[model samples]
Target: MSALDAATAFAEGLFEELRVNTTDAPGITRAAYGAGEEFAHARVRAAGRELDLDEATDAAGNLYLTLAGTTPQLPGWILGSHMDSVPHGGNYDGAAGVLAGLAVVHALRQEGRRPERNLTVMVIRAEESTWFPVSYLGSRAAFGGLPREALEARRADSGLTLREHMERLGLDPEAVARGKAFLDPARIHGFIEVHIEQGPVLERAGVPLGLVTGIAGSFRYRHGRCLGAYGHSGAVPRAYRQDAVLGFAHLVAALETSWDGLEREGLGATITFGEVATDPVQHAFSKVPGEVGFCLDVRSESEGVLERLHAELMAHADGIAQRRGVRFEFGARTGSTPAILDPALRGELAQAAGRAGLRAIEMPSGAGHDTATFAAQGVPASLIFVRNQHGSHNPLEAMRMEDFAAAVRLLLAFLAGRPA
Candidate 1:
């Protein structure tokens, strides 16, 4: 097998290792900063050591494994993605990207061909907000952009603050609290992330890889609630009832209407309301529900679109509140800004793909990624999406080994300044 092929095989082995160890019945669970994440980190760290790479970590637990370049003084390149997975999520969502970085470096070693500039594989922490409700938790902390209050945010399952988790892992949460940045954007050459397309766009297009144009950003309300007055179901008349469920239904219908309008106007965004529930303790079949809780996720690539949606959200909520005699409260919102990727870097990768005879498509990513945090810091960044099946965030999510290999070869070609 070629060096790239061998490296690809090595990556497959690591994938199996991760799956076998982190299995949670229905799917894998690599909760942000949880045991599964810790296991994956340890596995990657061992791989770095085996490769004899220079290893370093930031105060917030972002791992960096470096293959030192010949010209050490030049600004270096970084290939990375988060290692955390959502609860009962597929194994490859985040792990594939990090492992791809390693495969590239391993290929370089096998061929004894190192780039002129340093290449670092970064394994980011806590990208899945299912654990802690914060966007780009690790990348933001690396750049000193994470809010100090985020440390106090509790993980959904563990019910422990992020600071406490860091403390348990022997990381310096106080340094992150003091806003110490490990990365200086101006000093880096570029950032590239090799991720599986979280959607089926590429699969539908019959392409192996995609050069991402931009990443969508979003505002999320994880603890949103609609409050109303409870009454006996039979006794509450339609006009006199203050039904929180009805108020929620109104908001959903109104936003969906606005969403349809945007689509007709050629605007792109997604509106999702999950975790909808009525308090089981206080709710009953024979009584009107006094309150309903939900999680709101709104995403868009355009800032204006996001602003417009936010305006529509408030307007609809106000109308619903007045009509249904209920109040809406969205507590402690968290979000990231949409990022337009560096086109020059993207063009380079396209050129590499062309010379390697690999078909690649240029597309926009609706899902958020760590690459956005790099782009937000003025660092030129590219997100390479490998084709996959069944989409992401589920056990059925799948990617062909050959497609992943195609992405690795493309990165290698980009580094070598020639076809792979």
Candidate 2:
């Protein structure tokens, strides 16, 4: 069979396995480092064995499957994407990349085609931060981006320290901290990732594939403890009473106004107040100390712009807090990741897309991914995005099967070293 034919068959089989492994009644709930994730790792290892690759697991639970080349001593090409999904997420977001990588490896092996350097397919453990306090745990460890204090950080829901959680999952946190069982920086020649667009860009443009330009860096702010005294709603004077809800609304409005100006500059900046909390009890006679907290997710394609916006937003928060007479504490829940993509690899992806009879456009990814962390570590990395159904990170999230197959074909062509 031709390499493309083999790739198609491999992708179909992998997709079937993914569906069986991930699907639940409400939708796919394979949250990062969850039970479903462990199942995925098992399946991925099996697939690697099928392709006659050597599979190894890192201390962070990231899986690496290597296909030796003619000159194993030289730096090799790497392909990576996370296997963990968001809560109730669609199947394609991360799974597609993994299956695509498997397909590429299978096709290359069938053709007896090997590059001058080795090829490594990496399946990172955690990409979604919804359950885990820290995101990109797997990729960060691989890239040596994890700080020493991270070992002590506790998971929000589980209240277990990262070290304890690693132990529970059969991984050694100390080895991970020491950067053991990770790819050597000098051994990775370049990296590529195939992922769903997670937005409507490609589908709206009627394109089949995207040659990713860069991934957007995020500046996340946790605005917690907006305090206000509660009194009888009917008896308290509106002018004198401090309303935490009103204070939060004011802050949200101010953030929107500021973001509108950024939007005008074509910076693709966004601000989302995704959470809010108030006192649970409702009492007319008792004085309630209302506390409100919300998240500010600011993203930009430019690192410099992201930093400037972060500073500006913090200043705005302080001004709003003082004006509203609310005690405000601003904490950075996550730091910004600068936009990065491998220019040479991106060009190669575009050429591959063209050769595969696929339409390709360069676009920026607004969401966070393991690829961003890898890029930060000086790895030449790029991403390929298939079309998504509406937005992602929801139960109803989906992507076209044909689009996925087309992306796989393009990726196979790229791996086969086909010229434009």
Number of clashes in model 2? 0
Q: Summarize candidate 2's per-residue lDDT along 303-344 as a digit string, tens digits.
A: 877877767766766876677666666664675576678888
Per-residue lDDT of 203-295 in model 1, one digit per residue for the tens? 999999999999998988888999999999998799999999999999999999999999999999999997899999899989998999999
Candidate 2 global Cα RMSD: 2.4
**What residue runs in model 2 are displaced by over 4 Å at the alpha carbon?**
282-289, 418-420
TM-scores of the candidates in the order shown: 0.98, 0.93
Give the CA lDDT, 0 to 100, for residue 240 in model 2. Answer: 72
The best candidate by lDDT is 1
lDDT of 1: 0.94
**TM-score, cand. 1:** 0.98
Model 2: pairs clashing at backbone N, Cα or C within 3 Å? none
Best by TM-score: 1
